[model samples]
Target: MFFLPLVPINSTTTLGRQSQYPNSWDVVRHFGIRLSDCFVVTQFSADPRPTTASDALPAPRLIALDWGTTSCRAYLLGPDGLVIETRSNGKGILQLSADPATKDAEFAAELTRLCGDWIHEAPHLPLLACGMIGSNQGWAEAGYAPLPSRIMAKGPALTPVETRQGILHIAPGLVKDAGADDHGLPDVIRGEETQLRGILSGKESPASSIIVLPGTHTKWVLLDEDEVLDFTTSMTGELYSLLIHHSILGRHSIPPRHPDEAAFLRGVDVGIGTESQEEGRPGLLTALFSARSLAMTNDLTADAVQDYVSGLLIGSEVAGFTRRWVGRTSTQEPPRPSITICANPSLASRYKRAFLRLGIRVNTAADDTTAKGLWHTAVLSGLLAKEKA
Candidate 1:
């Protein structure tokens, strides 16, 4: 029931770049259909005002939400799933009251506060949400869809939570059982599945590709066309934060005025070693000490130390994944799969740099993919039917 509204407005704000309209226009052209119908609104507001009928925008067809642990983003989509406007706030699930008696009420209040005006104006619009909002800790438990599942295949019904406004459909997360290929441990993904669907929507997905989502816990998802073959998670970001703030490697570190790309690449080079070096040199465990050692020797600046350590961790993760999953040997190179990074611009840039250093070319998904994924899921789940207009 919690509806949101979007309207086109003029703004020079682009998602990540300084250019105006070029990137947004490119997305419209890429979709091929509904060029005239599409409205690209990249500007988001922390506190969005209500829209009146006088504005005369296209009617919103759906209200999509990407609600996570630490933040929640809501989007209003017009015909063809064009992003109308977006509202976000820091009231993530973690901010909700801990008392079970008040938790549901808290969630309802938060949703209403986020998009109450839209709900009042468009009471019947379908509402769809993804991410931790459907987890055990979220508003309701939308269980995991089993592994080796089709990304767009229908039929694992969405969990519905009745809110003050209406029923909100929640997408289930994906789960993989412990198996020979999964490092003998099970894995789960909640929010990233929606992002993956968004990345592949309206495109002829490659036969096989590696989708990397960089975050606190980075995910390396392997997809074969529409199906999710397998995935692995790496805690590279979390570890980096821990080391830089709490560990010895970061003891002398200070924030760099600018990024030290050279230092970062040097760390990457060490992590992705030559065959001879790989055979004789120690692994990440031993190399981690070099951050402090190099600093002590005055060979590395305190400001650059953090970037160097970041590169080392990310490079190690890439090297490990490639070796184990790709089955590359010390002497023979394996055929590389197409890699795409779906993340915010900053995080994506870092991962892209790391992969390029390892001789891997990668594609970056659009920044608005989460919203697109939510819309796609809503359509596929029958929450929003395709419109002819």
Candidate 2:
């Protein structure tokens, strides 16, 4: 049996209004590709034709998209899954109209506004998407794929949504059942599985590895080769946002002009109990108040308070995860698995620092995994015709 958490998108949720039509030149410049290059085509005939210089260049094959809660990213993938061009906007699911009467229309309009040109130029190419766009509150619910499954397998079906442009195929999220064991809690993952598929396609390692995706709800996935053995999620990022915006801890915080590394590391030490003088050190609950008290006492600057609190939350999350998953005994400790962080550079750097402080070295995966994952999935699922040698 498979189940997914259906968190409805609040109609009042506001991520700020985005322009209905984005500037095309700006998009081309941002993605570093020519506007004309995106629409190039090579006509074929029954008569034998010699390959031209243009024919040697990779041609667009798939229109891949990663549509999440707060943003949407579209990619034009060429032969062998190379990205030819890309576009992004703030028109996520949360930005759509809350009225059920017009929600579907809004989504369709957003999709066309985002990449209607690509769809128009490459009508022969297939469209594939992965992310919250497949959620219950999204344009359509793609459902969930059961656990103990191969990440690249094509058994589970992709949900198809009809639109003015074409039929968009949405990949299903993954769901794990609660077993009668230590790691029995049920969990669900949307979009990250495609990123995992992208990561595994590039590198092959015999030993197991941990893939950490940092965001509002961070996912710490356990990957054993091509299969995901188990995983866990932490709401550290969301908690930090709430504390900095809604809680008393953020009352005095003024955004720092520059990041305070010293203050952040200090908070990390406190949260991890490394700064504790006594054997019975106070835990995270007690440590959290220090953010407010230290600011009031002038021991910590108003500017540095936010970073300090961020480090504290992240440190506590990392410490808790290691304790639960990486076992330690009196005699000896088990070998830690290799960790690969898949995130933006800033977040990845922060996580790398946290892991390094604990003497664990980790690698950051490429930024194009989502696009590559979508292309790979489309190819594996028989959406694309086999390329001629």
Best by TM-score: 1
lDDT, candidate 2, equals 0.74
Candidate 2: regions farther than 4 A off: 1-57, 153-156, 180-184, 274-279, 329-334, 387-389
User: What lDDT tens digits, residue by residue, belong to model 1 across residues 82-124?
Assistant: 6665777638888894777899999999999987766776777
Candidate lDDT values, in order: 0.77, 0.74
* lDDT comparing candidate 1 with the true structure: 0.77
Candidate 1: which stretches are off by over 4 Å?
1-56, 274-277, 329-334
Clashing pairs in 1: 1-166
| Range of the 10 consecutive residues with the lowest summed lDDT in candidate 2 | 1-10
TM-score of each: 0.83, 0.82
